[model samples]
Target: MKKILRLTRHALLREQDAELRRIFGSDLEIIQVSETVPDVARVLAIIEEHRPDVVEVILPHSLTAALTRAGLVIPIIRAITRRVLHEDGTKDAPFSHYERIISLEIVSERL
Candidate 1:
């Protein structure tokens, strides 16, 4: 059987979902959640409910800090953005192109 992955983002975009699906392919089940700002409890609840192989969280730094302070055991991938800025400081690429995944464990270790 294929593995299941859970992805949670601040604003769930259809294009992001499609990109993820394309990357993972049909062999993996990708469960997505969209919330403006998901608290640690809500994130934990989702993990408990889904029991996914890995949980990818695309949230702001503040919330990610809270999650780290909460000390969650489940593996988490922090989805970062690498955007190209225009002369006016506007983003030049789509959201998909800016996504960069990093493990929470690695993030914590650096601290």
Candidate 2:
């Protein structure tokens, strides 16, 4: 089983749910967070409470900068995406174009 802590809007979470289902299969847990920009304290609280194996930061917003300063060691999967606009000027997706997936290992080399 896998634990995933996702930071994304509730309304714009369908994409993530589908992705997670394909990635982690049916043996995974997803904890949804509505914070556009989550501070260290809030992140820490969630981690401590749920003990998620990894945190999926969809809307990173200010999380990267804040986490860098705090120097927390954890597995963070960052989703980089761009909003898509249809030809008729319609927004069909919350976001599209799976640009790149960044895997950040917040840890120092163990010597």
lDDT of 2 by residue, 8-34 (tens): 664435675677667667788877776
- lDDT per residue as tens, model 1, 5-108: 44454554566556655655656666666655447777677677878765677666656666666755555564445578889877764464324333233254
Alpha carbon lDDT of each predicted model: 0.59, 0.61
Cα shift from native, residue 12, model 1 (Å): 8.3
lDDT score at residue 76, model 2, on the 0-100 scale: 65
Which predicted model would earn the best TM-score? 2
Candidate of highest lDDT: 2
